[model samples]
Target: MGFSTEFNSICKFKSARELEDLFEYGKTKMRKSGFRIYPTGMKVIAFDPENRAVAIVQIKASIAEIDFQDREITLVEMDLVRPLTPEESAVETALAYEMFFRDHESN
Candidate 1:
């Protein structure tokens, strides 16, 4: 009749892969259609696990990596390997940036 704590409750996550798996699923559990990763300088290079080209993700943030504590945010320069889309616009499925902005939000 009720859910269990171990399924969704917070606990000691043993490894990065485990956490990444959780994050991948976290996308669906989200109620908001949009998310903002502020301090845009903190954005890092990452890819979808399924190799799906999730483009124009309307104010959504893409996470390439994470650390639970002893965190550090730094900029790394790199050239763009390829474009998200050839037309410099979003696809129908990828219409992006509709969410309200917030300053204190954290990933």
Candidate 2:
């Protein structure tokens, strides 16, 4: 018998527009200080229950120029994922996880 595993991906977005597009469906916050919180656009990796995969991003893209309006890059790996439920999506990365509800009134 096998267990259904929890899949995870860590993405890093390089520009503002790219970040904006990634978080379109997510709750966005714009501060008066001009900072934002968006999804990280990183390559995906798959790991089974044993967690034996190399800690390396298998595929990568090198953009000569990152012009938001005139760029096309295919994301190498993407499995259909349902939009994150509010509770599920609320989980944050270790770096910023502490502020999850600190500024919720505005968002």
Candidate 3:
């Protein structure tokens, strides 16, 4: 099947305050920094104790395929990075995906 040209939404677990601010302006920032490694960027569907708020991220079409298909090869924070296990990293996104769908279905 053909794929979507851009991401419509991303699931993130935000602090109540963070969520409030996002909705306040109807806009949010998704930088390539502070999370998984994306040579360009990634839209996370994350809901661990740390992630925050639902976001709609638009990945550039040039990199979307890899961003969508690749896993973190390194954990990133600011300019610092550390190695990661691909299989291990999947859990958070997997869990987040489940939560996203569950929430969607209930609505």
Candidate 4:
């Protein structure tokens, strides 16, 4: 997708209730984990069909930084990648929204 298309795709949340649903799930996890939640921002990077990655979502609110499965290069990491598929993007967005809301409910 182009830049504009990507922007529009991210803006596809049609209703507050959708976000609310995600928030509720996050709240549940937060209560169980004894952690606080914050909206840390998320991006779904689709480098490939099987390499789609979810960028940082829950950051310093619960942890300092995103460790990305221990693939941190420290000195040099890759830049922005491709766009995620519909399914992959949906999952990442839901996870981020759920995590944020869960943290809120826990606190």
Candidate 5:
């Protein structure tokens, strides 16, 4: 039997390099912010500090053996099931811009 999950994918990358590029771009653009991951073995959600953009990844919990507490899981072994939606992207962008300006203003 197969289980079903619901999530939205705004874009899909064919390779790890592409995903890495996107992550790098966000890091450089956002500046002083980083991504956080919440893994529950079956599902993983990654987002920025401001919680503007989020990426949800679903894994085959039945077949995969994962140690939830072990934070060393390899991304290559897991699958990227979904991406941020248009609205999520917009929110993230806006938050990032706000944070950037706020940081500079405080200096």
Candidate 6:
């Protein structure tokens, strides 16, 4: 199965190079996980490996306009809030574990 989520705001990175740099920064800050680009190539999600935090970015069509341009990376507009608390992570982890086991059992 696949996962889906709804975002209220969009972030426009100047170019793919800029997006890559942002992913690298997230990897270093989280220390355990990196970023994930969706198959559609329109969204990117970064999260802490331990489930402590998550940041999702939806690329705007304007990206295509600058796809070949070189420019500095910037988080044009972001609405994602702070990282999750330990308790929140715990609950999410539990639910994820349950789903994994249940899915595997049926298989």
List the pairs of residues colliding in candidate 6: none
TM-score order, best first, reads 6, 5, 3, 2, 4, 1
lDDT tens per residue, model 4, 1-107:
11111221122222344334333443111111112223334332322212223322221122222245533111111222334467876686566456443453332
Q: Which stretches of candidate 3 lie over 4 Å from their true place?
A: 1-9, 29-34, 38-107
Write candidate 1's Cα lDDT for 33-55 as tens digits: 12212222232222232222322
RMSD of each: 15.4, 15.1, 14.1, 16.4, 12.0, 10.9
Give candidate 6's error at residue 80 in angstroms: 3.9
lDDT of model 3, residue 60:
29
Clashes by residue pair, model 1: 58-96, 58-97, 59-97
Better of 2 and 4 by lDDT: 4
TM-score of each: 0.19, 0.25, 0.26, 0.24, 0.28, 0.29
Across residues 38-73, which tens digit of lDDT does each residue of candidate 3 receive? 323544332322443233332222222234445322
Cα error of candidate 4 at position 29, Å: 32
In model 4, what are the clashing residue pairs, if there are any? 26-98, 26-102, 27-101, 27-102
Give the candidate number with the greatest lDDT: 5
Query: CA shift at 92, candidate 2, in angstroms?
Result: 4.2
- Candidate 5 — which residues are off by over 4 angstroms? 1-42, 45-54, 59-76, 92-107
Output the worst ten-in-a-row residue range by lDDT, candidate 6.
Answer: 27-36
Model 6 agreement with the true structure over 1-107: per-residue lDDT tens digits: 22232241223232445445545553221110112222233554333333222446434322111223443222232223334466765665456446443453331
User: What lDDT does each candidate get?
Assistant: 0.26, 0.29, 0.35, 0.30, 0.38, 0.34
Instruction: Answer with 1 or 2, whichever has the higher lDDT.
Output: 2
Q: Compared with the true structure, what per-residue lDDT tens digits does model 2 show for residues 1-107?
A: 21221134533323354334334533221211112222234444322122222122322332222236544322332231234343433343332234322342242
Q: Give residue 77's lDDT in candidate 3 (0 to 100).
A: 16
